[model samples]
Target: MGEPNTILHAVRVSLRMSQDELAQAIREDGREHGEPNYCAKRNVQRWESGDVRMPRKIYIRSLERVTGLPIEALGFATPVFGTRAAAQAPANGQESARGEVVEMGATSAPGGAVPMTKHNDHGTLSGIWLSRYEYHSSGRGADFTGEHFVVVIQHRNKLTVRSLPEASSNPDSPLTMDLTVDGNVVTGSWREETAGDGYYAGAVYHGALQLLLEPTGRKMTGKWVGFGKDFDVNTGPWELTFKDASTSKAAMDRYNHRP
Candidate 1:
């Protein structure tokens, strides 16, 4: 908490990013953490100027995420000195030999919820989510495998979705979404449009999906529900795993090139 976090300021300058830009990046970087923590430019200013004695631990964590730097090296190691990782205890009367109580909803800040671990949904969310869904309808069932790229508008909490076509999945279908992200949980609705005739045509469904932002922010567990023109709803469980370079370029390229 000393020296005005010179390291943070230096990193910002080295990256040629203004405080506003850095604040926005940090905010967006945290959206996957369930109701993302917000940090304003004024907060950044306070941190840079040492106007605030200590930056919030969450802010430091977010800064590390955005700058790809380490919090300890940033001269703000006090809050994290004794931090420990959180682990889930086996249920049904199962107990560790040490008999430590496991609290499932531990938080991020000091003395808050359990300590953060990898995949606690504290990472970036603007990437490709490769999802596999197994759905069941009245008398039929199906498995769907596809890729979806959600391009997030930084600091706005809004995103546009584009899904790759595979096995009867909609092609060139674009979805507009408004999501409410709470810590480790994301619940949202999307409006889907299509060109066709009859009940299954022309923006037939405004679907909803509830997802948990897992530790790595890459592995997501959720359910997507949609009501069709006939009013019958199909329910499914899905797994959305994050994709990296070689696997995710298509959607991003399309997103960037759109006119």
Candidate 2:
């Protein structure tokens, strides 16, 4: 087997994120950029085991965004042009599909401008969050409350939030939200897949949402309008609160088991 990618592994550990969390983060990041990604725990395992020396270009971009590190620094070999390697290179001034020129010593990190620091600030919504919602069920004629552990990733004006499974062995009934930030208002859409054995009978739900960011930037309060199991339009209050700046396993467990 090839040498293990300790650099990649170490960075993930420092961020207090597990392999599964990293994979989910990367997948969410790809979706934010309109890229379809199938990243999973198995992919992270291969990368850390050195079974795959270099991932595809889309994964590379996601890695850069999640880790705030340059590809070369992550133990990946960037192709250097000129010398014998440039013999088969594209002609000069010719750009790749992404408009990047393949030339001698042209290795540039996608997020080189961003400082390599732990994301612990409120300036960007890139961390763990607690999602809570309350809605009245027509069948029961009572209010129902739900909570979830979610990871929020913000890339520029775009934000993606995805719920995490309670445990590795448990199946995920994922809830995903895609939102855009304009000043202090966040407008977005949300989709959720109900648990198969739950009260909803594994129904799929989706709707539009709009939230106002609190002055502290640690809380978002909003309302969601969606079709319920009865096929009737329902509205409810939804909120997301900043929980932890780190995605460590301990943080995840704490949020998952919240009271």
Query: Over the full model, what C-alpha lDDT does candidate 2 score relative to the true structure?
Result: 0.69
The candidate that wins on lDDT is 2
lDDT of 1 by residue, 1-259 (tens): 2224444554454344678998898898788664376678987776665444345556667878776456654433233223234223222111233332222221232222343333323544555445455544343444544334433321123222334332114544444444555667777765555536523355545678887877666666888788855788876775556654232335444433212
**Residue 177, candidate 1: C-alpha displacement in angstroms:** 2.9
Question: What's the count of clashing pairs in each model shown?
Answer: 13, 1
What C-alpha lDDT, on a 0 to 100 scale, does residue 11 get in candidate 2? Answer: 56
Off by over 4 Å in 1: 1-121, 131-147, 153-169, 195-203, 245-251, 254-259
**Candidate 1 has what TM-score?**
0.40
Residue pairs clashing, model 2? 16-248
Across 18-47, the per-residue lDDT of candidate 2 in tens digits comes to 899999999999999999688889878877
What local lDDT does model 2 show for residue 186? 89
In candidate 2, residue 194 scores what lDDT?
76
